[model samples]
Target: MAQSRTTEHCVQMPAHGAGQGKTAAPTPEKQLNCFVRCIALIERLGNALGTLAFTWATVVLLGGYPTALSSKDFRYATAIVSLEAARMFSRNNRLDYQLLFRTRGAVRPLGWNGLTVIVPAAIIRIVLASLRLGSHSYYGDDGHLDKRNPGDKTNLVPSLNIFYGMVLGQGALYIAACMLDIFSFIPQRSLARQGGYADDDRLLRKISGQALTMLAMDSVNNCLTMLRETGYVFIKELTSIIRVDRYRCVAASLLRSMCLHAQQELEESDQRELSYALREVLERTLIADGAELEIFIGLSSQICKVIPEDLAKELEDSHIKQRFVMRLVDVLNSYTEPSPHCPGIRRVILEQAINMMEHDSRYTNCFIDRHMAEALSMVEETVSEAENYSLFLGDVGLMEAREPLSSLMARAKQLLAVR
Candidate 1:
């Protein structure tokens, strides 16, 4: 009887322990999951606070709130806040396969909705601030009309402040959107694995379209702002701004974006109209000599990769070919002394010229006949006596240059034979 009682006690104790063990196992897991949720909540709250703070600061500074800060300080603060906001929005609202695939159009605005509110609000604040400044200037600080004359300097200060604030705010938003668009190309592994080429192409087109749309909106905003500020002088001021070399960089970026869109369309549709549009943009861009020229060169290199046949045919136009060849010769002439930035551009131009030549015998014949002498002259100037002799004696850079030129010459000769 004692043994039986001892066995029963032992079995009951184990069952009780087993029940406790089962109860204890899930407690740690539950605690871990709760902790993770808390951390996520804190992170989200922190982001919200940061974004709110940035938006408030932008409004206050651009709105010209009465503060100890000078105009310069206000300008700097506005710029900094704008950049930070851009960085934040870009981080949160990335353009990726996940965004393109998972989300429906109805819910898409929620991703970047904050930006829509913030940008317009800032613009309105600036306009109201300008109105207040104008009112104060006209009515005097004491609220009575001042006998003092409103000089040009008096009017100019407020206008300048308003113009700068609006431009800075709009520019920041544009930069952020651009950054988002550029990064949208990063492939999401899960989406990519499930999707096909057709899906990827669709995503690319959507991204490109969005980028173009943003560019258009920015251009229109700038034009409208200029018109509002300068009134009748808007056209003159707009022309002057467009003429600036820095502004040409913007145009180049716009052109590059357009080219990317055209390239995509060409791939999908293989339409001659797209090719012609690309040719027209390229022709206009090539005519401009400035930072734009470098951009056009880069664009041409990209075009060579995508639309070589179409581009070659476009170059076969006598006027276009002549202008392009002359530009190449000028670029070569600049590279005669071998500057730091020249070699890379020179190589691309040469490669593009070679591609054109390879694509069409007629273009090769025209290019070699019209520009070969200029190229040889530039090459002779570039290759010094020691470098020339070292070619037979095997100098690295000289040998590298010789090989491409020789290959180009060989291609030209072959084209001439075929002609």
Candidate 2:
């Protein structure tokens, strides 16, 4: 990978001596300056067109369409007039900042921040032009009018609603796009603050932590917004789809993919705590209930397979892994129904799997062994419950299997290792 990726790129010119023959010169700065001037001119032109559109509307009302300009002429003129105004604001750098103000609170990090601003701005202009055309059509005649007394224009107040609608619609689009525009400078800014304020390790850790935090926040926000907007429709749709085994399989697979991504990023990062935190967040978000406990296990197993044996041993020995597993088991158990064959009973099974995976692996540090043993014991109890319910699952699916109270009690002793 390159050392740094800049948002704006400039081509380098070949070195030239004082007497170099007719060498082409660098013009990036000149080009940028020209772009700024063009944007300013567009904004000024837009303001002028807006004024002209307003004037035409007012004059059209005072004088009938036949008296001023033909209906078609008015429509075309109004469209052109509104488009210029829209173009002005769309090209203005300040408009992008205005869009982001709701979330980021009036911060101008990078001016307009590349094409993230350009696209919506152009669309807004097109929309404005359409609105102006529609308004003129609605208010003005199709060139057919009574010569004696044309229809009154005072009833054309609804025509101005175009401007109101444009602001609401285009403004919303601008804000939505701004939310999605992720400039690379966010992490860069945090990294820059590292000097003197914090040591390299601490700064890197914080940067990594914030990255995970942003991911969590963005995911939740997007999901909740989608749910809020289409929750009722989706509920009906899900009712039909949830019954299909294939749908469940597809959903479980997608969730596994998301979890795998989180795990991989955490594993790659040098900050162990941040990685563990991300893993915990994933578990908490996706595995809230034991509905897909087996899928979680299968995915974790797959991820563990890809991990290097030596590093996996170090990871297992570290407090990060054991602590995350313990917390996960605890949360899983709390949500697991109390039955011998209930998946909560399978929590211990996962612990055993984790232990088996780490058992032969040696840790250079002895202190980690105690925590590992404690985590294993917690897993053992959960597994003992599952053992009692295995007989029930022999006849029924694991989801439907529930252990008898007496069997559960009996299994508790084995699980607790009490004679």
Error of 2 at 25 (Å): 58
Clashing pairs in 2: 46-84, 348-383
Q: Report every candidate's CA lDDT.
A: 0.41, 0.36
What TM-score do all the candidates reach, one by one? 0.33, 0.25
Per residue, candidate 1 scores C-alpha lDDT tens digits across 24-49 of: 44332223223322322332333344
Q: Name the best candidate (by TM-score).
A: 1
TM-score of 1: 0.33
**lDDT value for model 2:** 0.36
Tell me the tens digit of each residue's lDDT in model 2 across 1-419. Answer: 11111111111112223245665453432233233223323333333344444455545432444444545545544554455445444443233222222112111322365445545544655565556555554434653445466455433444444443433344444433443333433433433352233344433323222222122221323222222333223223322322344243223332233333333332232233223333432353244344344434433443443343433554556535554445444544453343332333343334333433444333212213333334444544544333332112123322212334344334433333421
The CA lDDT at 202 in model 1 is 40
Name the regions of candidate 2 deviating beyond 4 angstroms.
1-171, 176-331, 334-419
Q: Model 1 off-target regions past 4 Å?
A: 1-274, 312-318, 339-343, 371-419
Q: What's model 1's lDDT at 96?
A: 16
